[model samples]
Target: MKELYLLLLCMVTTSLGKNKSVDLELDYETASRLAGLPLHCAHVEYPNKLSQVLENQTELLAPSELHPIFYGCFDWHSSVHGHWLLAKVANLFPDTELHQNVRTLFAQQFTEDKVATELAYFNRKWGKSFERTYGWAWLLKLQEELELFKDEKFQEYAQILKPLADYIADLYIDFLPRLSYPVRVGEHTNTAFGLVFALDYARLDGNEKLIEVIRNVSLTFYTPDYDCPLRYEPSGYDFLSPCLQEAEVMSKILDDDLEYSVWLQKFLPQLFAENFVLEPGKVADRTDGKLVHLDGLNFSRAWALYTITKKLDDKDMVERLNAIGDEHIRTSIDNVVGSDYAGSHWLASFLFHALETRNS
Candidate 1:
């Protein structure tokens, strides 16, 4: 199968050069469709509809050659998309056997290599008990548990997670000097998610100690000035903006602050006012003069803002998010390839979250 794909890819490349109409607008959807070409080799010619690509790819994954991990890819990006799809499938088709099968498979990942890989990271750094700085990516993976296993199922897995949550709380306060630096602030999304998850875990595990941990971390991100910070950027990857927003949301929910909630309500539309434009059914990257993605933060501002704004129930905000989501599907469905898949996956996951929030 690998050889066949390589040969077909070679042929496609050769053919591509000869064609003058190979409109070079390569995005996630285009590449994802190209990758699917070999299987349904005759479904359509070179230029195909982007949205149809995944449908075709799904067909290719059927029966004896059923890649159990059909949605499997090891990176952070893959996990997000696969998890999003599993949740969507479960919610959309709760009674279907196939959906249940996929849900079970997704759930098993909690105890599988993917979980093991993350747990190993936690283990190596924090002694399997979350005593150290867990990266932002860990929180995203933690989210998979909520989708795959909630309530008692989550509690059943609590033994492995509970001590880690405690360790995380201790690590935060004990290493306050490190977490307090501005230059090291707001660099990842997983921080808030991690803290929120920790708090939830604490609540589940009946550990009141976690409440303080959650409060400090939550307030740290919501702190007005970066110079006096609570969240620290580890100085590597850039997933920070959303983390701050997530922290803010966590604060409001945990504290039940109507004022903070109002602040969020006001902040959403203001941020999206001039800087954002969702046109042609795709979320456009900010055209603002200020560096929106300073040093490879990329176009994260748009998505981060979109994620936070959707949480507010403002009628205008919801309408804007809906438009952005449609654009995301249109843009994302047409741009699925390799590392670029992350953007598509991000959109897919966001769409699922947005949809679920609406339905909820």
Candidate 2:
């Protein structure tokens, strides 16, 4: 299983070929642009979403008052991953002006007192399920990037955030067992999408308990599943592909090459056949907050396709998958920047993660 994880990581970070399908080169120019998305919004705390449960008048505090660092980017989860996006770009392109800007942001947001306040927010009864698995997953992923980043400052920041990260981890350890049914929606509540990054953090942290629980829970929820209803996807306001996210989680859990193949064949048989092809989702309105999710759907599908294709042994199938993933990315990568505040507030992280899986 550990070997499978290592293979997946290698495949995710490697280029498919010299003949690229999209112009996703994360040169300093592109990285800086994507970095600008989070940088611009991470501090702009208005037009925010709390997703909170107000128990008393005191609970009506503003978003920034609730989560200082994760208060911008429209919502908590977006801002959490927004920080992850900055950590990623800063690590990839060091000594740049944006890198220093990221450092400054970290210095301001990751202070011990601020993180403690953030932790206090989570402990409230009304806030216990604040972001549930979605925001929890992104927060852990941010911790992963902070610890992975090779810098003294980043290490200190990671320590400052460690208490909250550990708290979130405990929440996961406690929550998974109580979840009798999986959330299969193509939205923030999707259980599979929530597990992807959290699992990544578990493996990175060498938290064997977390890895074991995720593997066990995945097996229980998905092992017997077959013939996923993938065609019925992108229901109106979806930022995620339920079928693809589930497949990605399965790809992570099932270790044996042939075991994964058999499972995938039963679950999404269309992948192995050349007659069926996946297309990028269309968004009718980028200005509408809900409608813009299709743009995110396209990028998310790219991430899943890029990672899932690496599990296949068939060379031709791999190439086809790569092409599909590239097209999905191409369809939305350029649209992410300056699209609309609705989409622009959160789409760059999706685009960045997808591009990284394809060696951007």
Candidate 3:
């Protein structure tokens, strides 16, 4: 009877794994349709037939494009989108070798030299490095990569892997002590990304010492009154503009503090009405409002809110967000279709967390 039960359990486990893999593939395909990117032309074969092709043929398409440090669109956009797609796909296919490809992308992007080249200026002036919002998002992929595969086979190359994440996390930790005032803040996305990375690292390493640091940083921007500054941080990092969406997303994910989420919900309609502009042609970032500076911060938030509401089983919130995202996508198909800003690829990451999250 014991042997029979063991065999049945093994079969059940195998079947469930297979089911998850299939669901992930379907989700990827659906996400591609929702994103409407042109992957077939790029010739970047996707993991599943339904998945959108995500490749930047910029080097092939334009070899003369010299990378002017952080200014090159190809290097900046491709690196971010590529990693986003890879990480989400890996989350979907966790037990399979598909995750290996995700690791490869991270290894290529987060190398010691790349980190130095990208963040050297910030390191010198701030006495620490500044990871762009996109860079912070990339760290999410790397963290997922390490979590999905932490066994002996993966430990061999741990040196190259751990330092990059450790450096970023430690840098943020060091910055905590340096805050001159209790209200020190920066771009919404950067601040949110920093909190998410810090929280995830704290959870992964069982390092509870950093929880206060996370709490303090979060409190600097916590908006229960809605009269606070709603723009992005650093004052000058306004390529896409900052908004409340990224901070909300990070707050939802990192702290699970319902009070913060409630605070966010209270200010949602006013900010959206004032700052968000959804036309049938252009992308939806931030526009007019009290927070006039964050134009590119909406899509990331829209997608994130969509995911979180569903996870929280708040159908009303999901309905509201889906309407918002659908409206934006309808209006700004051109800007969102082929981009990571749409948050299509990170579906797998959210799903992974939904599957893996514990009440603790």
Candidate 4:
């Protein structure tokens, strides 16, 4: 039976070809299962160690105690995007059991009091840089999802979450001017990855101030960048591709497709090559929390590539990027489930983002 199951898995894998359908049914199933995993796991056994300046011994609190709305899924950022995955899936598949589960969970967690506590945590003196731009970006992404959700319940939830989102936006506007250099890492602190999602949210909500700041900061930090060294990517423990992510954001901020195409050509010239290829980052150990980040690197890279392809006029280049993006999704989507807390805790959100962004 195990051998047969493996064979069936192989067949399913084989079916996900360049021209094959994305299998939204299977995607929805995986999203439902993975999103449900961290929704109620308040006693997260392995939370991310945070930077804290405790005034007293009594001030130190457990993850659940400190972050009432987002205290699960191993870390605050993971928990933030976990809720994002649930919200996205629920909005897309409203009649499914997954949607119902999301509704039930939101009822308990999205209360005004809970959000107020969350806001207070951010406003704390020592917690100014608690999650910084990474967590802040996911919060805005979640708000964007909630704002887009047409359900009255989700709209109410969005309204309730507005104060915290506004706080994070204020942080971005204040922080970017002071940041003389952008962090070019492949991890959570990557400035490009943060700005991309935040920019999206700002545009959707018509926040001119946030939008202008993002555009100016993005151009200031990235406009002169050229020939990003893609071959040196997938730094150990990396979850975001620095080069591709920057390119992705530039594609959005540039004025016109002509400008974007020119910028992309200068930024990642290898994409124009007929034989250019990007293999997905391999993970040697899923049980190791940091090592598994390579899998996320693949998903996020795929998202960037897919988004970049949309802005280009070259049909051949677009098809090539699409194929590569599809391959990256295939590499990691199947592993989003399973019992490994290290990877399972947050990978589904990356997988969901990759597939949903590509297909959308």
* Clashing residue pair totals per candidate (backbone < 3 A): 14, 0, 9, 0
lDDT of 4 by residue, 1-360 (tens): 223223333444432333456543336545555565555453364555545678688768876667888887778888899888879888988887668778878888888988988888877777778888899999999999999988999999999999999888889888888899999999989999999999999999898999999999999999999999999987998999999999999989986999999988898899899999898999988889899999899889988998999898999889999889878887776666553778878887887888777887
On lDDT, the candidate that comes out on top is 2
Question: Pick by TM-score: which candidate is best?
Answer: 2
Q: Write the residue-wise lDDT of candidate 2 on 121-227 in tens digits.
A: 98998667888899999999999999998889999999999999999988999899889999999899999998989899999999888898899899999999999
TM-scores of all models?
A: 0.49, 0.93, 0.53, 0.91
Model 3: CA > 4 A from native: 1-26, 30-81, 94-127, 132-137, 150-159, 180-190, 227-243, 246-250, 253-258, 269-298, 307-314, 330-360
Candidate 4 regions exceeding 4 Å error are 1-27, 40-51
Candidate 4 Cα deviation (angstroms), residue 125 = 1.5
Worst 10 residues of 1 by lDDT: 43-52
lDDT of each: 0.38, 0.85, 0.40, 0.82
Q: What is the lDDT for 120 in model 4?
A: 86
RMSD (Cα, Å) of model 1:
12.9
Name the better of 1 and 2 by lDDT.
Answer: 2
lDDT by residue (tens digit), candidate 1, 186-251: 443245544544555445555565556556656665544322221233123443444344534454
Model 1 TM-score, all chains together: 0.49
Q: Per-residue error at 267 for model 1, in Å?
A: 6.3
